[model samples]
Target chain A: MPAKKLNLRKRYGLLTRGMGWETTHQKMDDVFPYDSFEGIKITDWDKWEDPFRLTMDAYWKFQAEKEKKLYAVIDSFAQNNGQTNLADASYLSAIKLFITGVTPIEYAAHRGFAHLGRHFRGDGARIACQMQAIDELRHQQTQVHTISHYNKHFNGLHDPFHQFDRVWYLSVPKSFSEDALSSGPFEFITSISFAFEYVLTNLLFVPFMSGAAYNGDMATVTFGFSAQSDESRHMTLGLEIIKFMLEQHEDNLPIVQRWMDKHFWRAYRLLALVAAMQDYMLTNSPMSWKEAWDVYFVENGGALFEDLSRYGLKMPKYHELATAEADHISHQIWSVFCSLGNATGFHTFLPTEEKMAWLSEKYPDTFDQYYRPRFEYWHQQQKDGTFEFQKGLPQLCQVCQIPMVFTEVQTDPMQISYRVTEHGGDKYHFCSDGCKDIFEHEPEKYVQAWLPVHQIYQGNCGGPTLPEVLEWYKFTPEDIGNYIGSQDHARWQEWTGEDKEVKQA
Target chain B: MSDKKNTVFLILQDNDDARPIIESVEQDNPEATIQYQPGMVRMEAAGRLVVNRETVEENLGREWDVQELHLNLISLAGNVDEDDEKFELAWN
Candidate 1:
């Protein structure tokens, strides 16, 4: 008779455990110096649970299958001209935003997790991070490959990596990832794995994926399905890391709590871009931003925080503020993009009457009262041939680096909710108290931030003038401005055989 | 089952990959309430929820690793007890 096969538990243990040895040549402390500097006490590295029992062999097999399926679809999407089937060419603006702003973050995550995989003491955690590191790299590659077809038929996707580092608006996501990547291993995991992946991932991934599906972008939808499984593992790892830290030692509670508070706000603020994409960018909207937030964050995140309460962990600070801002952030972000249309890598347009009616239904209290009038006024301005983009750059928050566009949702929707602070006689501005609190905690770190607006003012960008700045950003005339008469708009109309009369009516 | 305080729940992305697991969950937990939302599904039970690997495999028509459930899992409430054969969630 053949010997009984090992079960997954025992198999995982044999594969991953007892891989590390006591070093007589080098002290374990010196080898893993980063584990202790953050003041997290780990009495036993053995207590670190392997969140998922995935071995390297199994991981390779699963990913290979997924890749096979994904590439097949992507090939077909290109062969069949999937771009023409989209709800509208205007939808590509959201995809351009995604590739420019979000895909680079996936690459950043790859680097970040690879760092964690090396620095952590526990074999379990090291293995998990190593797997996740590969997963992130895979996501980055798949995202690029999936969107490359769009790049063939569109503008604004030519120089994502170059633009990610230098563009003013891309700084929001760039700085957010850098903040996590530069932290200690524990804090990096806490900030990205726990706060962003576990607490706020659905807000980012679902909107883009579902938006893709709703708009007839089959290639993107397939990529989403492929990435979904890997995301689940990442999310599980996130939950495990937080629970592991909180349960390991009492001293870690407050430190973890503070990191959670800071990173949650950072992640939420970065998600404002996603909010605009969901609410306005998708031609056939799957759901409103408010609706997605309510379901994903309010209901799902509420359940997560409740379970976490057993470890004396509460919700991230100012979660209520996030809830309040949900009704307004999407509109605010869309308006900001519209105002800076000439400077943006993708086109921005006023929502059609049908979309405004949808927004009014989705946000009855806020939309009709505060945002619709501004859009209408802009539309009229465009019609009268006097439309103008905002020439001066907006003030950026020091901590999140988002332009100071958010308003005091609870008090007055018209008043921009700005906060101020001073360190060493240097004044810094913030979009909200959440950002102010983050900066106040680590004033030294935030002060060194290479703010885009400050850099542009100092003439570090291409030149002093707007045209030079656009040249520096690698923007062609086709890449920036309103969507109506842009090259993308023209091509899409040509492909669909819709004349000016049909499009206007 | 109606008492909110004692309930434990699991939310999964609604898709073809999760259909068999969802069916198995419904079969295993009779007291659970199932909800369908856009792109997701939620299952809530009064005090406990268990996902048996055997049942899922039966529904899937193949061997199913219990860990694969995480692929579709969005969120969950209650303490978790997971192993090779089964996954369970309940308040401690």
Candidate 2:
């Protein structure tokens, strides 16, 4: 008789935990130096659980099937001219943002997890991070391939990597990722896997993926489904890591809390871009950014934190401020983009009157009162031939790297919420108290920030003139400016046989 | 058990990947309320909710690993205990 096959748990144990052996040539401390420096103590590597029991054989089979399905959908989308079926050409702006701002971060996450896979002492964690590293790379590749179909027909889709490196707004996401990548392995996983993938991922993915489905972008929706399955594993790994840390040693609570406080604010600030995309970019919006925040953050995150309270972990600091800003950040960021439209990779436009009405309905408390009039004024300026992109560069926050556009919503919606600090004889600006506090904790790290606006003034970004800077950013004239008469808009009209005159009006 | 404070819930993205798991959950936890949102489904029960691997595999018509449930899981509220045979959530 054939020998009985090992059960799933034993098979996983042999494949993972059983493979790890004590190092004889090198000290374990010398081999894994980075994990201890962050002040997190793991008393026993044995306590670390394998959150998922996926073996390499099963992983390859599952991912291969997913890839096969994804590519088939992408091929069908290309064959059927999926671009022409979108809710509007305006919807592609969101995809453009995804490629430039979000896709590069996926690559960074791949690098981060690869580092973790190497540095982690526990075999379970190493294997998990290794799988996630591959997943991140897969996400980056699939996103590029999926959105490349639109690159053939759109203006702003080209040169995403080039723009991601040098562009001003893109720096927000770039800096956020770099901060995570540059941290120790534990903090990297805590910041990314826990704070981001688990706590805040739904806010990002749900909006974009659902927006794609709602707007008829079949390729993006397919990739969203494919990536989301992997995200689940990432989220579970996040929870397991945090739980393991908290359970191993009582001393780890405060250290974990501090990292959560800092990284939560970082991840939340990075999500400001997604807020803008959800609210203003999608022609047929799935839900308002505030509504998504309520569901994903307020409700779901509330439950998660409540569960975590057993480990003495509380809700992140400044969570109340984030909740308050949800009503306003999307509008604020969209306004900033509209002001600097000429300098951006994608076209920006004042919302149509219908969209403004939708915004008013969605944000009854803030939109009509605080934001609608500003958009109306911009619309008037365009109609009068007096509209121009803001000529002066906006001040960027030292920590978050977003422009100082957020307001003191808790006190006065009209007052810009600016915080200032001094470090190394240099005054630094922050978008909020959260960013300022993060800077104070590690002024050494933040002072080295590559503020793009300052870089341009210092003659670093391919000369001073706006046209020179645009050229350096790899942006064509068609790539920047208002979406109404832009090349993308015109091509969309031609493809869909819609009247340009009607669209312009 | 009917107290709101005792409630434990699990949310999964409502898609083909989760359909079998959701059905297994419905079968195991008859007392739970299953509500479908736009693209997600939430399963809530008083005090406890459990996912049995055998039931899921039966619903899936193949062998299923308990950890594969995370592929569809969106969020959950409660302390979790899991092994090869079952995954359980409760307000312990």
Candidate 3:
């Protein structure tokens, strides 16, 4: 018996060449037109032979066609005034979190892959980088476009890109992106593309997007899955590169391990947004963010890190810490939303009794006693027409990029809350010191966070008026103000014959 | 990518639901062995456990692609060792 020799390039070319990359949904048979990205070669695609080994023509055609079909759905939904069937008013909150947190990851991927486009010694790796670059851009754009649809229907969406710059809790995402963007190009690839996208992203995308499908937000669901299809390839590239590096030099082991350790923690913290959206916002069969993390981050990832220990790299230093925090983080974040909705660019409504029950079932430790009462008060206020948003901005955590809402983890799992520590003249608050240390690692990068409240205070936003501030944030009229009265809710009412606005108190 | 044999470690949920998947592997493939713990399954195979696409679909009684595997997975960690034809998932 002869051992088979591996040719990564040949395998890659088999997967991608001549696929009609240009036209969307022409046919599964159309190969990726090498001419699509001129002068870039996909043959080096062999760097990591995808076991599912999607051939080029089928790959491009399926992808382009999927995008095309998705776009058509978007068009029809918009044409017939389709935003309303979106199931519930609460769903938009999930979109708010997605726009604020996940979309930035696309841009971060763009920056990282762009570096891979430069660093890969082979044309194959470099070409994969090019495709990834385009994919990331489209992901970012599609997210923005899909989210912009809600702008006319909700708030908290004005200039999400800019909002990312200035929002308090948004610092969580902003800082994560900045961290990935700042790493050496290869490390960036491992952290964002491989570790974040390939390893953990499926947890967020596949399930959540499927949830979107069940809800009325077809556009969002479509785009999320479409982006994920591309992510499959990017994941391969990430896996290959890390593996290739390990193969190239034994010394690369420790270096790669260090990066793996650094990046896994960095990416995990950014996923806190998923914690909130999954557990709190989804209209149906909501998967608790904590459970999602256990499966996605802790179990899947923690297991992987243990395997890598043979290389002398243990699990990411913060893995346990991040895992330990998951069951509690979403409630902590939404706690801020409930308490601070007025000052926010988006709306936060009290969860229904049914939803509250679901949450209590999911978060047994804190919900019934700690968080639910607070939401109950907000519900009462809503009934009374006296609910007030947190009037001002929160101080942003320098490292995690979140607002200082996180609680300290006591020896007992029962109590979790926030801890603040001061560094120099600036006071740094964190969900925990793990986040604080992640920040202390590169305070220079994080110190410059653009907190939304800070911007409002600095008068850097449009003006003193919320609307004016929204405008400065690049949010349009439909993009700003109370979500209940926003366009999406209005459209939902019209479609369901329920009427759009909640009559003013 | 390391000179060392690539390994994949998976801890399955303790629920009784995944028994079929566990049983099928143990019975169908002599190479497949599963040790059950309090809340998880520790599966260690010397090399990749090949699941014919056809076989998986037949067993699951639905379209069972790689993505759908997430359903049965309690937790999985492994290196991707492969060529174009097959990718191996193994324990170190």
Candidate 4:
């Protein structure tokens, strides 16, 4: 008799799951102890589905081929000396932001998914989380390897690993990942997978990758393509997990809704960095940050929630606030970073005439009316050789850790938006009412937040002075300040045979 | 041209893996026109654009799932109608 072949779906279904569990030595609860602590009621674990239906054999084979292709590109890029091929040296500032703020989050996500893979009771969910865990680790490795080529000649790329841990601006991402990592398995998956990956990921990945391509950075583009391929599968897992949980029990609706609201605001605030990078840092930006938000969020995100409404879910709280702030958020944050460029780990520059015109065309409602005058004034001061930098430290929000830069909801944009609440005989400040609500719900968790500005006053950083703090952050004189006369700009001019100093003399 | 405003379009990242998918799109929707950008490709057609999973499978010589279209998808500008066999985008 000849052996018979099996169907792929049936074989994957059987091999990936449906292996009967043995309880001879220990009970199920004892083996999976962390499954039930979050007050989440899963009536039937069998309802969970792996939408990708990927088997171990196919995953390894496909992934190995992708890695081979990625490495080949990286090798060619290095051999051809790709560092001198950028649109301008100022473009590297966005890459600096990515390495410091985003790469470490990948490592944190890998750790969180590894824990979820072990702890979830559902076989389908466990397998999906385990695969995502491997994908995240690969993302981190490939990202570091791809970007490390620039470190050979660049200044700011040297201490990103160390800076990610100690720098003030970086606490935005560090604290975000730590928040997700510290939660239970359900909330962890809801935060990183559903909120960050499904709802907010394209805003972070797409613009940056396309900007890299447009600016001639092929190394970053290769890494972006590799990582985004895995992201589609992770997104499927995210959607599947939400549907699985909501379908498991009707009681899960309120819990899931609350998680969505909380994680949405958290993830949205973290994307302020991406918004600033897109609008201000890229020398040859593909599109405006407002346009990307309109395309990715208002269009796609609105449709996604409409689909989820079938399961008794609604749009996240403060969804309207996010829509309203799209025109102003990036502009406001770029202004703040420009004023405080002396303290940042990346270079900051006022927009060129070409870029300012693009901004005015893209943001006709806000840029010309509100932000253009301020940027033009700065450009005038820069021409006069008065190089201004904001002198004082900003009061950081206890919940989101951003400076108090957001404006009041209906009031003038000049007035800073804030909410003060008394918790344990101490007043806590938040940037918005949404953040205030989050703290009021979990006062105990948020009261212990490590606010960066507060730590500096308390002498937890290097010293009291600005230079000492900059030293503690591992920044050289070349890494910070305005981009026009910075070392990188000078070198770029020399490389392109457009050195302005000699010609001016 | 103002015709672009009336067209439904899809943009995908350009890479070796997307070749079969592009071929499928060209074969299935003959009225569609293609444009190239740095590191990406765009397909535009008047009124509608459709991507057939069977066509993609024929080009790639494998079983292709419609959901796999997202692996190369960058952006699209129309209402989507998707199922196990087909993915169609139209202004309606």
Highest lDDT against the true fold, candidate: 2
The pairs that clash in candidate 2 are none
DockQ of each: 0.32, 0.30, 0.12, 0.21
Cα RMSD (angstroms) for every candidate in the order listed = 2.5, 2.6, 9.3, 4.4
What tens-digit string does per-residue lDDT give for candidate 1 at A1-505?
9999788778778777757666789999998888899999988777777645777777787778778867998999999999898888888898999889988999999999998898899988899999999989998899999899999999998999999999999999999999999989999999888899878877777656767877788887777756766776787788888889988999999999999999999999999999999888888687789998987789778777877888888899999999999999999999999999999999998888888989999999999999999999998998999999998999999999999999999999999998999999999999999999999999999999999989989999999998899999999989999998898988988888873321210
Q: Candidate 3 lDDT, tens digit per residue, A1-505?
A: 8877436446556444533133356632243322222122223333544433444444455557556756786777777656666667657777877887678768877877776665554455556776788789888988887777767765566666776776555666776777777766666777776678756786777557766776767788767766766775676567667666665556667767666766776677666667677766777644577776765666566555555555565666666777767767778777777676655555665567777888888888767877788779878887799977766666665566566666554464444446666666877666666666656766776677665666677887778887677566555665444567666566667657873433211
A362-476 per-residue lDDT for model 2 (tens digits): 9999999999999999999999999988989999999999999999999999999889999878899998999999999999999999999999999999998999999999999
Name the weakest run of 10 consecutive residues (lDDT summed) in model 3 chain A: A33-42
lDDT of 4 by residue, A232-271 (tens): 5676577678878888889889999999999999999999
lDDT of model 1 at residue A476?
Answer: 90
By summed lDDT, the worst window of 10 consecutive residues in model 4 chain A runs over A496-505
Candidate 3 CAPRI category = incorrect
Off by over 4 Å in 1: A499-505, B1-17, B31-49, B67-81, B88-92
Number of clashes found in candidate 2: 0
TM-score of predicted structure 3, chain A? 0.80
Share of the reference A-B contacts seen in candidate 1: 0.16
Scored on chain A only, each candidate's TM-score is 0.98, 0.98, 0.80, 0.96
Order of the predicted models by lDDT, top scorer first: 2, 1, 4, 3
User: Which pairs clash inside model 1?
Assistant: none
